[model samples]
Target chain A: MTPKKVIIADKMNQFSDHWNPRVIGELNGQQVRAVKLKGEFVWHDHDHEDELFLVIKGILKMEFRDRTETIYPGEFIIVPRKTEHRPVADEEVELLLFEPASTVNTGNVVDERTRTTLQKI
Target chain B: MTPKKVIIADKMNQFSDHWNPRVIGELNGQQVRAVKLKGEFVWHDHDHEDELFLVIKGILKMEFRDRTETIYPGEFIIVPRKTEHRPVADEEVELLLFEPASTVNTGNVVDERTRTTLQKI
Candidate 1:
């Protein structure tokens, strides 16, 4: 691929929907995606891949079956494979996520929020 | 792992030095590291894996053998494996890097700017 810069904010503005992610780049067989989030997300887990959350704007509250954590801008969290979790936000949030190309944002479960058209940036 | 926040600013403050990266998390055997950069970095490349550079703040200009691109705070770039490149910044910039845990920041070529102890955040 050509040597190019992936302008994040510019990429984010290309789409106006929430939950649906836009694929920005990939390396080592893994994909990097950016998504806009709101309210709460479905609780689920990927049986074979971990989920990485890099908060870009606003605050993200990701909760597991027992405990929960808040991820702010410049902060990141890794939800290992097979670990169930739900991501929530009291307000709107923007984020960058890293995981296998096939990973469903909603994990093993499916819902209206489980989007698959996330194109590579 | 417990559900907890990885406050990047707090983590960044934990270290007062420069060049060295702090590992915040990892998934699927790849590590996620954060580093502060200014001026320029040694020209180098990893022979085995691609290099990912995500600009968190300020601007990043990466020059390759043929072309160069500017990556801003919301942008990212992936330098394919074995692609020689140099990172330059007119001012200080904060960034996040994703590569194999064993991949050195300076690629295969070592220099004074290379850092080895980037601990896990």
Candidate 2:
């Protein structure tokens, strides 16, 4: 098997599109993805999957029904399964997402922003 | 449910022992752990699981049978299952480990340095 060492900064430079996640590495059944987030995302919930978001660059605001959490660089937030949440960013934010291989970007609601097939960077 | 957002740096500060892993968060079946590594570790292989090592504070050298990979902060390496590898750090190094809940720190080796029960910080 080939060796896999991912330089997070190098992978972030591979893509410039916002909200599109590019797979960086995979361990067990989970996929490690890097995404650029700007503006706001739709409110959705993953019925059976939990998503972990680790901020690498800018600030990320995860808005829930009751409250909002601000995640800075070197910080991570996990959105539990079946919980409705929306992610927003005032500026461009680089994030590393850890989730299962079967996760969809839009979760329960799949529209134009939904990315079913994620590209590996 | 309560919000779970982990500040990697803060969680890392809670531990001081080298080679011992502290759990930070859990997603799906995998547990995200933080460990401080110094000196040389035992050469072992996970026969049934793959482990991801993400450098957080210092340089970490992963020595394999064929070659050695140096992982710096903001970088990560994935050691495939059944691959013989040993980790070493010249000075104090902080690392974030991503692996299954049942994964043992020493892998196939059960030595005194092995941490069977990882504490959560």
Candidate 3:
């Protein structure tokens, strides 16, 4: 199969809902996803998956037990596995997330915000 | 340990060399790297690893054995394993690469352009 190019901005325009992630590309058992965030997320941790969040638009505030990190556009942060954390956005934020294909959006927490199945863009 | 934010532009400004990639962040046995590319690269293919290339600045022309793909800023392409591909740039291109930690820059070809040991920025 031929590999295709994925335009991140175009993919972001496809979805308007907040907190839902859409898979854009995949490679080597890892998936690249585009997600929109408007408010706050649940505090949780993945037992075996590491999450990388790259801010595409606006800002992202990652709150951990010890500290909170403010990530801006053109910046990224990696949250290691088994570390409790939360992501909060003051305004609408666009992000690209990289993680294992088996990762769930809510990590260990199974709440209304949990997304076990993601749509591919 | 607290996870720190990595500024993509700041890391890009640290190195000026072309074709050499520097590791920026690592997670789940995968490495996120920043590299500068110009001219043409050798045709090579990783036997067991897939590579993802995200264009940060300029444009990248990925030449496959059957077709070619032009990736632009805010766009990305994934080269699957065992696929013969070469990346060419008419001008200088800055990129973010996500791949397995064991992946080599030159894949199966060992030449002067091959980089086995990479520096972390």
Candidate 4:
């Protein structure tokens, strides 16, 4: 395979949709995805996979069952498996997400916000 | 465990050694490490692990057998397993590396620069 670099900022400009993650790269059964977030996401939890959220731009407020954590740009948070959490952003936030291939966006609870098929950007 | 966010910039400030990777986080047997790069790295290839290099600051050039890929800030490149490559940087570059926990920096060729024990930041 030809070695190619994935430019995150260029990928972020390809789409303007919120909460939908675009596949950027994959390795070791894990995938690196980019997502644009605004407003609030559904309260959910991945029972079998852990999710790593890296804020590329803007601030991200992750609300959990007990407390809320503010993730700034250049910061990352690892949401353990089976931990119910919600991600909220006041403005458009660009982020990179890392998780296994079988991980579902909405976790066990399937909703309209769940993205079953992710597009590669 | 208290949920804590890993700030990439803050972690980058904790060390100044070049080519030595410091563990930042781990998930599913894979580790997220931060490395400061300058000059050129040795030509090596991991036999069983694929390495992902995300340029957090400055520029990185990965030289392969056939080509050289330029990875800029906010860009990432995945060096496939068994692919002989060397990373070169003109100046100090901050990068985030993702790979299996057992992955060695020197790949198949063991040298004095090879670090057996990695420090956690």
Candidate 5:
């Protein structure tokens, strides 16, 4: 099958909703996703999956139990499995996420923000 | 362990060599790498691994047996397993690569450019 190149900015413009991630690329049982974030996310941790968050626009505050990391554009943070954390964005932040396909947005928490099924853009 | 955010640009500044990739982050069984590319790469294909190349600076020409795809900054292309391809860059190009940890720089062929052991930066 022929593979196509994905333009991150073009995909980001396809969605504006916060916290919902859209699948853009998939390979090696992992998915590359694009999501927008504003305000705060629930504190949670994945039991078996690690998540990589790459900032595309604005700043992201990744809060762990002990400290919060401010990630700017061109920066990325890998939240290890079983480490409870939260993501906070004072303003809308665009991100590209890399993780296993089984990873849930809300992780271990089944909150209102939990997304079991994601849309592909 | 406290997870640290990796500044891609800062890590990129640490290396200037072409074609050699340095591991920047790893999650699950996958590795995230940063590499600078110029000229042309050998035509090769992984038997079991898919590779993702995201352009960060300059332009990348991904040549397939059938056609060529031009990838720009903020753009990415996935080379599926068993698909012979080559990467050509007229000028220096910065890139982020995601693939399995065991992936070699030259797949299916061993050349002087083959990197069996990759360094982590």
Candidate 6:
């Protein structure tokens, strides 16, 4: 297989959807997905794998049930497995997420925010 | 446990060393490290886990035994497990690497290039 080098933002423009992550690359069986967020993400967590969220652009606020952390463009936060966290953005937010290939945005909870059909490129 | 937030670059000034990666955060069974590189990294690969390299400040060139790829700021590349690769930079480069917490920079092969005694913050 030819090695993949992903310029995530450049590939993200090909689609126009919020919350749905498009799988861009895989490493060590882990899938790298880029998601676009506008308003708020569902309060969810993956119980099997940890989720890594890197803010590509704009400010992102990750709100837990009690505490919240605001991430800037150059900042990133890792939501541990089973930690109920909701990501919110007052403005448009671009993010790069790393998790297992089977992980869903909302994990096993099926909802309007649950994106299971991940696109691979 | 107090949640850790790493402002990578802002903390890097506390130390001055190339190739030595500082353990910043860990999630699940993996750890997040930030390393400062100036010249060229050794031609080596981790046999156990894939290496994720994200360019934080300058350009980076990851050379493989067969092909090579250049990564610029905001770009990332994942070197698969056991894929012999080396990273080169003409100027100082700031990078963030994510892998298993037990992963050594040189991964079992201790040499002059290998940097051990990782600092935790």
* Model 3 per-residue lDDT tens digits across residues A31-91: 9999999998999999999999999999999999999999998999999999999999999
Candidate lDDT scores, in order, read: 0.83, 0.92, 0.96, 0.91, 0.96, 0.80
lDDT of 2 by residue, B33-91 (tens): 99999999999999999999999988999999888899899999999899999999999
> Per-prediction DockQ scores?
0.69, 0.78, 0.88, 0.75, 0.89, 0.52
TM-score of each: 0.90, 0.98, 0.98, 0.97, 0.99, 0.91
The local lDDT score (0 to 100) that residue A48 gets in candidate 5 is 99
Off by over 4 Å in 1: none
Please give the lDDT score at residue B33 for candidate 6.
89
Q: What is the docking quality class of candidate 6?
A: medium
Query: Which digits, one per residue and each the tens of the lDDT, describe model 6 over residues B11-110?
Result: 6777778888888777667777888888977777778888888888888988888888999887888888887887898898888887777677876466
Greater DockQ among 3 and 4 belongs to 3
lDDT of 5 by residue, B2-51 (tens): 69999999999998999999999999999999999999999999999999
Give the winner by DockQ: 1 or 4: 4
Question: Among all windows of ten consecutive residues in candidate 2 chain A, which has the lowest summed lDDT?
Answer: A1-10
lDDT for B86 in candidate 1 is: 88
For candidate 1, the per-residue lDDT at A14 reads 86
Model 3: docking quality category? high
Lowest summed lDDT window (length 10), candidate 5 chain B: B112-121
Locate the minimum summed-lDDT window of 10 residues in model 5 chain A: A1-10
Q: What is model 1's C-alpha RMSD?
A: 2.0
DockQ of 5: 0.89
Runs off by more than 4 Å, candidate 2: none
DockQ of 4: 0.75
Report, to 2 decimal places, the DockQ of model 2.
Answer: 0.78
Between candidates 1 and 3, which one is better according to DockQ? 3
